[model samples]
Target: MARAPADSHLTPQATQPGGHVPVMLAEVLDALQPADGGIYLDATFGLGGYAKGILDSAACTVWGLDRDPQAIARGQAMTEAEDGRLHLAEGRFGALDRVLEERGVAPVDGIAFDLGVSSPQLDVAERGFSFRFDGPLDMRMGSDGPTAADVVNELAEGDLARIVRDYGEEKKARRVARAITQARGDKPIQRTGELAEIVRGAVGHARGKAKAHEIDPATRTFQAIRIYVNDELGELERGLAAAERALKPGGRLAVVSFHSLEDRAVKQFLRTRSGDVPRASRHSPDPDPADRLPEPTFRVLFRQAKKPRADEAETNPRARSARLRAAERTAAPAWANFEEGRA
Candidate 1:
């Protein structure tokens, strides 16, 4: 995953099953450097975008995993079409290590994760991931988890405020949470539209303006609730650890994150695993020789994370916020406490 000699290396947006044009496709392929006869894993496998690119890049085998049953079902066609080169699994990416072990597939040559809700999920009104779409207040990535509606109706105002404040980084979390609690007391906030309206009312819009609000008022609240209900940030943390354990020495790991929360976690994970010490106080004691850490388990592929090029971002607005961080695994064992590091 060391930076190779620069090349354009861009691939045309080959339409995938769910119409997703994988964000930062060129950057991911470049960082991964997929080789012939290699075995790789697509930890997100949303619409088989990156997975398909990996397979098409070389004579390799790909194991694609996804928690959403719908994604898995759609990817089945991809598996059959690949004629034994593609394998699809239905499960959380956090369980990648266990899933690989159970399937007798470990120490893979590479792994890729496209973090956040997929385009298909957001586009479908029934999935209820977007504030733009009016539908049921269900944001669970998996079928079994508690829905966003459940959290809105059941969680205490303090807890809800914390979710918005911490997860969404919304400044007006307290007000929004109080509004939700008050509204839900009369009846459950069962629809996305209802919740959106409540959030808007609580936040307020520009005076004398009716049609255009500065960004959707519900955006932050909805994002916070969706992340909380799905435990997305938690899943990402675990998934990164699992990837560390699953990759072979020299294996590549590429992650595409859509927001600061996710990008920060990835940045910290890679930096710590690569043995970069966090800035310390001058008063800190000298390190003990016996307490010296083991050799780094990974080497970051780039000094800075890659973002979508201007043209790509222009073509797909969703790609605007995407950030990609990648690394090459080392022979050293994965750290047991990656979470305690900077992120």
Candidate 2:
């Protein structure tokens, strides 16, 4: 998983399926260093962007996994057309090992997860992922997921406040949660506009308190609701742990996260697993090489996470938030700073 020399390694092939140009494409190829005849896993195969790139970079086989049936419907065609070299499965990325085993596939040479909602999902009004287009209050990534409406109507007031503050980092969480609880009591807030208006009314004066902020005051609240309903953080913790076990020695693990919340988890996971101590604390003993921990089970591939280059930013604005980090599997499994409930 050490960084590849340059973008030349990806080779110029048609990886941009139907104008769905992926962000930080060159950087991903450079980090992954995909080799010919390798088998890789695209753990979050959103519209097959990264999966297609991996397949084209070499004669490599790819296993794409996603919980959304719509994505699977688009990707199954690739598997069919490629004569099964490209396989798509419908499941959570956290269940990586089980799906691979069921497919009779062995541990792969590399695994990558692109953590973000797809363009199609956000652009489609009926999907309810974006506030730009009003629709039902349904922000579930999976077709069969518990929609945002279900969560807003069902979760207790204390739980709702906690979710908004923890996931969204919104200071006025109590106000918004309480407002929603009272509003929904009058009638079900089934539409996106209704909920957005409710959130706006709840936090009417707080909007002027923060600078460097853009978009409606409701953005953070919506994000919190979506994260809670999807159980995204829980999925990430489980998925990362699973990916660690599913790679062979020297196998690469790369993740491109779209926000600080996700980046913190990915960065900390690699750094902590490297057996590097979190910044020295007041409570503990001094340093020791023996205390330095056993040879780390995974070798960190990047000294720091990679950000989008200038040129790529112009082509795709989404690249702005992306932070890609990678690591390589080393010796036998050694449990390190990886936590039981990082989410």
Candidate 3:
């Protein structure tokens, strides 16, 4: 890591000497296939984990994006370590096009996105992403904006219920919302455990001392709050579009998403191949066939999703949740929002 410049506002966590356990190394590299002198995009530059691997494996230029200012600080160090081949952009992955524009970047050779929160975001209690640690309900991934507490303590009961039901896919959203409403009457839901306990109590009929779920009972609720707090799904939509615009002809796009919701969004986005309408429904108006078409933008490299080997899964349990998908761009001119169905 390079020495920090003066006037740095980065936290100790950003400067902390820790290596992130990358989720899927072999699959990411195999799919992206970064070539020497190629420009690639790392849409989610958490901890610079994938960036490190890409830099080491290929003589490519990696332009990385992340919402966390802290991540950008760390990435500044990493770029220095890589002799300035890595470009760190302080923004959400959804804004890939704008960031690239400011950097004078044209179409890129490849794009890699690791969807969902990073380990550091969850492990740190003060960040408030996990219920395991009792901290203030502040689940912002960037740690510089509206938090889970604001949602829990401020959203209307109906909206809260919807958040739990839709984002979380939790069945007991009504009861959970009711519990939150009542709890706030006595005292605000100020901490993660307080909210987690309220969720557990609301599901008294389903709670098992053994295990409410293979995961935590509050996992779904927490996920719902975090999703709303960060507008994760919306960012995903914009990121997909931006990536489509960024890829060069025959360029690759690889994404490793951790859950079904994210995987489904990616699955549909890739299936639709961004900037093209879904053939699933032809009722939507289409441009006249008389007009010249831009040509197909991408073709699927693999018909099926890829998973890590058993050996790899054993070594990194996190890889189990990873579902990788890849595609190569064609000559198409990137119209926009291919996965309109997801929106």
Candidate 4:
């Protein structure tokens, strides 16, 4: 079965001295198929894990992109270690084409995106990604933008419910939203612990109850707030498009998504761009030939997404929910009007 983001546990083996283990390194390598003299892009370079792996796997140049300036700064050592083979850029992956163009890098042979919050971001209490640390409720992936506290304290009850429902997939989003609105009336919900308690009180935590089993009550709400604050889903869609534009023919693209929503976006993007759209049912008439879809721009590497083996998940708990999907850029011109349907 496909896993959710309920498992936020980080095992000791998950990170080494300077970097965390790249989830599904071997699998991603196989999908990317890095070759000598080829250039690759790590669109979500958190700690240079995938970048390092790609550089080591072949005599290729790696250009890493990250929205977080801290990530870009931390990766300088890796750039030096590679003796100019590694180049780190500070920006969202959606702007990857521009970043590459500015750096004089041509269309790359492979591009990889490991979506969602990184381990370092989750570990830092100040970033407020996890409730385990009781820090300020700021979940911005980058240094800019509105913080989680702003959303919690300012959004209307209905808006809050929508975010919790749509992004977090929380069933009790109405109750949670109402509780938040009520609580914030007295004072702004500033700290992670305070907001978590509010959510717990709103959504009862009965161990055996339906939708209230093992996961913490605040998990879904936190995820929703974080995703909203970062505009992660929108970023992923644009990143996929940018990858299409930035990849050479036969260039590979691999993405690792932790939740079902992100995985669905990746699946649909590949399906639509690969000309695998479903035909109208027997009861419905076929479309006109003039309205025919464009040719596929990418060839999917696998019919189904791949997951980590049980042993790997057991060793690094964070890998438990990671889902990998890969594809290759085709010779056709990019689809100009690909639609990203609602989640």
Candidate 5:
């Protein structure tokens, strides 16, 4: 399938009415050229941004999936408004293929994923996705998992350190972990404010002469806890593979990620699937020829990730770090399910 032009446009109305702009909206629409009669999946249907945009663009069908039951409930009115064109399902995108199959849906024409926490999730203090708020330290994207409070209060210091270091890319992960353990020992660190204060107190001193624009010291730690609570990276790995399996031949896959880790995963997946493997590093041994990968199943749409326009970034602070990468599916069969070590 041919890629839609990079300059494909979207009007302001395409965004949800309440100013909830989906990051990289135009670029995503360009990647997934929604056409009449086509079926599309908004894999992370947070606030129904991309799903609403796709519905507005064509007479297509959209299955919007979100693990958060609150999100699904909120979208019911919009689903009814769309007159059967839009369907809302409460489930993780990681199991999108199964969700569709259970509903007797066929392969989709396009799939769009807007990864990471949503504005609603972050803005609502009770949800505990951001350090800015001081509500309960619950960060589970879905209803069932252990909350962020549980993670900080129960995990070994070493385990907490590893999560912060690996997931948040915090250089002083050990220090942060130590502080959390020490603080929680006094009493369970149950609130977002308490945790944020603990993290700030631990690392704020290290930022001796912080620049005016520097982010809060607690940002990384909060992000780390939220990611851990949600198992987000693992879900992305599984979701991407699910998208590959769910799309029909020539189907499009568009993903918008807000940070480097998520973008890196999407980049590596597309590069490897499109047969653009990187040269083996001299320090590493070559892989066995007998363990070759399956045939290419996707054609990468862009050599580099698409970033939000300067104007858009300026207007929407959340769009600043967003990066979009897209690809088109091929006739080749989907590869084996994603394994942790493989990605």
Candidate 6:
């Protein structure tokens, strides 16, 4: 799981030197309830914050997975320090079931996913996850796929507009796309700073004026491009399904999402799998009994998603947007039939 910047008051004064603080650590622990001799999975495993927390909480084993090779390399010392209690794997969380199966691991007692770009990814300008510092427009989370530069330079204006509008939820998507296409026509847009400037010019001009304390005009565009470059939404969908298959009955699942898109996906998945779907009104016709839905595979742990305390949010700006949702796996079989219908 990704950790917040190391400035939060929630961090232990005696925590390992240079440790990154996991967001909502106490709440996540409460949801997972890690116990002795049990196994847990830290599906994101960025900087090993959640994994370390789980290890410190109980005499349990933790399987850490990350798509980024750099993250896996960073975890080597932690794995060794844990005396074989922590195992690190390099793979996307969406393929977690396969990763565990290849290792001959059993179903886990709990799983945690901290979604969105990690702090390191955002802080390192060379990684291109943020425009805060100038860098190449390469936002691929893992090294395998196309970069944000590829999307910005190669995609059609309409396609770019669609991505910004759909993924970023930006209202000025068309203007942004037009600006990108016009600018790229002069030369390939290759840097984060260049794109940020283009977006700011486009949106800022449209607004005619800027207000103090307003968010950067380029924030949504950057978010949209990053999400597109990483196929984040699709990965989240697959990861949730994989988690369903990997978890044991009564096993806990906790997901922390940083944005509405991710949080909505998590919320909808839990609601549908837990049979919390909306009921039909009296005016609606009843469906045939033979078309009955499959048994619920999960039970939601909370009626609503949890947010960080005001103090924690004040201390760490990153934690302000975090939303946590948790649920426990049911004995019912994985939702293979249900997934097919939905697909």
Best by TM-score: 6
- RMSD to true structure for each model, in Å: 3.1, 4.1, 6.9, 5.1, 3.4, 3.3
Candidate 6 lDDT, 1-343, residue by residue in tens: 4222233333432234355667887788778888889999999998888888788778899999999988899889888899999999999999999999899885889999999998889999999989899999999889998999999999999999999999999999999999999999999999999999999998884365667446788999999999999999999999999999999999999999999999999999999999887777889889667555678989999979999878777767788899999999999998784563253
Worst 10 residues of 6 by lDDT: 1-10
Worst 10 residues of 5 by lDDT: 1-10
Count clashes in each candidate, considering only residues at least 3 apart in sequence or on different chains: 0, 0, 3, 0, 0, 1
Writing each residue's lDDT as its tens digit, candidate 4 over 188-281 gives 9999999999999999887565572267889999999999999999999899998988999999999999999999999999988888887778
User: Candidate 3 lDDT, tens digit per residue, 152-228?
Assistant: 99989999999999999999999999999999989888899999999988865444466522666688899888988
lDDT of each: 0.85, 0.78, 0.77, 0.86, 0.86, 0.87
Give the top-scoring candidate (lDDT): 6
- Rate residue 30 of model 6 by lDDT: 76
Greater lDDT among 1 and 2 belongs to: 1
Write model 2 residue lDDT over 59-128, tens digit each, in one string: 7888889988888888877788777679888999888978888888857788888886778778888888
Clashing pairs in 4: none
lDDT digits (tens) for residues 68-119 of candidate 1: 9999998888888999999989999999999999999898999999998988
Q: Ranking by lDDT, best first?
A: 6, 4, 5, 1, 2, 3
Which regions of candidate 6 deviate over 4 angstroms? 2-19, 205-213, 282-285, 340-343
For candidate 2, the lDDT comes to 0.78
Error of 6 at 234 (Å): 0.3
Residues 45-118, candidate 5: write the lDDT tens digits. Answer: 87888888788778899999999999999999889999999998999899999999898885999999998898
How does residue 340 of candidate 5 score in lDDT? 28
